[model samples]
Target: MTLTNRQRAVPPSMFADETLMELPPPVRLTGIGLRFYVDDEGRGSATPALIRGQLWPLDTAVTDATIREHLRALVKVGYIETYSINGRKLLALTDWPSVDRGSRSRLPAPPSTEPLARSSRASRETFAVEGGGEEGREDGREEGAGEGGRGPSRDARDETEPSPFCRKHQPHGTDFACGGCASARKRHDQWLRAEAEAEAEGLAE
Candidate 1:
């Protein structure tokens, strides 16, 4: 992938540095490949790259196959996922999936983000009052944790995963209103509605 202005700031030491001088060339290639996902910009980006112009005089001699070799190793390790876009092979750091930095942090996974904590609690309360277990327990744990600040804190985790109030644990699909939409909507439902909404909005524009 090509380096963006932001990614260009990365130092060559993060990629091709003295650590290579100590290892056999093949091992060094593997090290660089392993680091593909660890580099700050790479970890924070869907597309990560070696700055074409920034690597240094020592980096010029590297071959495309060698880079690809390293990339393959990284792919095997779940460091990044390699795919082709527009017929050119591109690398995405799956460890840090989003291209948006506003969405990334050091957490193992994103935190639960429920839009309306009170509403989830109300739902949980109703579920409990109506003799529901799975729905109320799951929602209550989420809502209560959210309300009491017991769940993963914003400062402590990413906010891009399934919400803590996910209704999937509810005993029956009938429990949640079919027409209601939440950011935490049942997995397939959210995707369907959002896809349709995006399509509609695109057509409107």
Candidate 2:
């Protein structure tokens, strides 16, 4: 898959999403990494071996099982959906397009041994679901099953839900701060540090 090497937009709501806020930090970071690495379609393989090999120099004490558990946690929280293709697992981020505020691309049809695999034509059909911000079912079938399967519910409260961090702005993600409020705080801290450093230099002279 050809992935764009540009900065992906991470909504502040991600930090506030009840689904994400409850996850362990490593899992949350992994989810963010997934967004960065995957194609616009949010298609990628996050097998334990790949994650361990690629996800930076983590402590050796953290076993593959732990990583797998984190991946499962992401799935459970509705941030990702997993599909089995030819005995291999493929994951798709459910809310990527919404978070990026762009049109989602069609998933490349996988070569599959399973009969559930769709034809090329069907695969090209857009997988866009209305209100894709909601949590998927516990079973992990966000799009539902069979001909009559009722898919998971959309996050109706995404717009209406107030962020815990900012009253005016919805929740967003940041390394140290959230949205506008946290960014303001960061700038304020930097200004204070610069002032303090200048004062110390003058006193020494």
Candidate 3:
């Protein structure tokens, strides 16, 4: 993935749009983030599992159902258009070229042709909900926590695997940075520091 120096734009009309205003906070935020990471043509692959992983931090336990519901909300708002190509669901942001001129260099185009095999995964997906679990639970075993004398699953604890982008913007089936994540991390750290300083000041008084 090539990193462009151009930052994503947020039009003033976004706040003015009646449809956007009616969306729930989670759905609205997710829609805006999607526009930032989608390809020049505003196309991207999204499954509930993929959305849960890429849209939220690893710790957040948003259910697939929840993600699907928000995606449906985006569709209702006309912010997204979904179609199937080769058994994969693809999303396109409507009128994307109007908002962003996009990269001059061609990236991989969205899948447009039929394939020999249809995906076994249903075109309309169904995901099993993890019942009674709190949101944002870490995927790996906590340090020194044990269960039935067995360690955490090896796959869960592995850290040697490098994610191409920061967890938030990493795309499914791809592992490469587009330089979008650095700004996010910087803002996060700044917020944390500000909170810490405010707490310190409060105690001092």
Candidate 4:
């Protein structure tokens, strides 16, 4: 397997995650180890034999059956998701934290599901920060902004422009407010709320 110089971050909240704590020790360890193996897009091969080879090459006791059981447990708790593309099984870290200065993955994305405000690319661009998780700069400014007086950066301008369409809400024009879009946004808000609650629980502990 080819490897890159990408750096990955483990959120502190991970240790306090109740669901993860309920998993068996070996399965939990395997889940954590798999995070390091995923590409920038948080995806990797899911075949049990291949996963065993990649994750436990020198450990004779770690059989392919053990790897498969661990994968099943991780999938059960939604720590990771497994899918197939063109008959090749693959796995993606469901909530993998973003890495700074990471290169884009060459791996194919998992099949599309309900469109969320935090699209796959957007999720990959966001990193967890102390106090709370926020995207881009804290002051609501794009990175690399010049001090001298200037108009909004290209990125800022692009953000202002309306998105044409997304996977689930496709074919809708810029002026249309499709129900699918609204439902996706609602689900995204719920996800944000859950994340905030999780973070708060971790902080309290």
Off by over 4 Å in 1: 1-57, 97-205
TM per candidate: 0.29, 0.46, 0.46, 0.53
The alpha-carbon deviation from the true structure for residue 67 of candidate 1, after best TM-score superposition, in angstroms, is 0.5
TM-score of 4: 0.53
Write candidate 3's Cα lDDT for 75-181 as tens digits: 76556757776677777665355445565423333332222112211210111123113441235423322242122223422332233334434454223322223
Compute the lDDT for candidate 3.
Answer: 0.51
Write the number of the candidate with greater lDDT, choosing between 1 and 4: 4
User: Model 3: runs farther than 4 Å from truth?
Assistant: 1-6, 98-101, 104-205
In the range 1-205, model 1's lDDT, one tens digit per residue, is 3223333222353342222233455644544443433344334222323422223225655555555565555444333455543555445443232344533444222112223344333543453466445653464554333334234333222233343232433333333322112223443344344444433433454
Question: Candidate 1: worst 10 consecutive residues by lDDT?
Answer: 107-116
CA-lDDT, candidates in order: 0.38, 0.52, 0.51, 0.60
Better model by TM-score: candidate 2 vs candidate 4: 4
Q: Worst lDDT window (10 residues) for model 3?
A: 119-128
Best model per lDDT: 4
- Quick one: how many clashes does candidate 2 have? 6
Against the correct fold, how does model 2 do in TM-score?
Answer: 0.46
Off by over 4 Å in 2: 1-6, 98-205
